[model samples]
Target: GVLPLAGLGAWVAGAGPVVLPLVIACFGLVAWGLHRRRARADCGETKIHKEGVKP
Candidate 1:
């Protein structure tokens, strides 16, 4: 929440050019991490579901 507020403040302060890419990158990283975590969970707990699914 604070992170979003800080980014919003930065945008309001005319720092979009610099902050936008960083915010986008951060969201990308978070999404990637979440996907990896879910994939790992599926791989661990669902052998039938993970059959033939290569890493």
Candidate 2:
């Protein structure tokens, strides 16, 4: 979950060039998105139950 944030910190701290951290952050974002989707599905929150309401 903290991968992207850590990568951003690394980049800001000058740990390496911007390219590498950006690549890592991109991958981290994808991974976090997948994880969040799976979690939402597990919680039965993948769809809206009605107008102005979420499930």
Candidate 3:
């Protein structure tokens, strides 16, 4: 997320002040998405592995 946003900012501002906020926002969104995914998995969600593996 941050990677793409920083790219956008750099394209827009050419390595100026706007890049920082864009990078921060991108990072925040990615972090939030990861946190949400983790939370969902923790609350009794079952994941299936490959067939050869024993559970």
Model 1 CA lDDT for position 53? 73
Clashes of each: 0, 0, 0
TM-score of each: 0.61, 0.48, 0.53
Give every collision pair in model 3: none
lDDT of 1 by residue, 20-52 (tens): 788789999999999999999888778865675
For this target, which candidate reaches the highest lDDT against the unseen true structure? 1
lDDT agreement with native, every candidate: 0.82, 0.76, 0.75
1 or 2, greater by TM-score:
1
Q: In model 1, which runs have C-alpha deviations exceeding 4 angstroms?
A: 1-13, 48-55
Off by over 4 Å in 2: 1-16, 45-55
- How many collisions between residues are there in candidate 2? 0
Which prediction has the highest TM-score against the true structure? Answer: 1
In candidate 3 the C-alpha lDDT for residue 9 amounts to 62
In model 2, which residue pairs have backbone atoms overlapping below 3 Å?
A: none
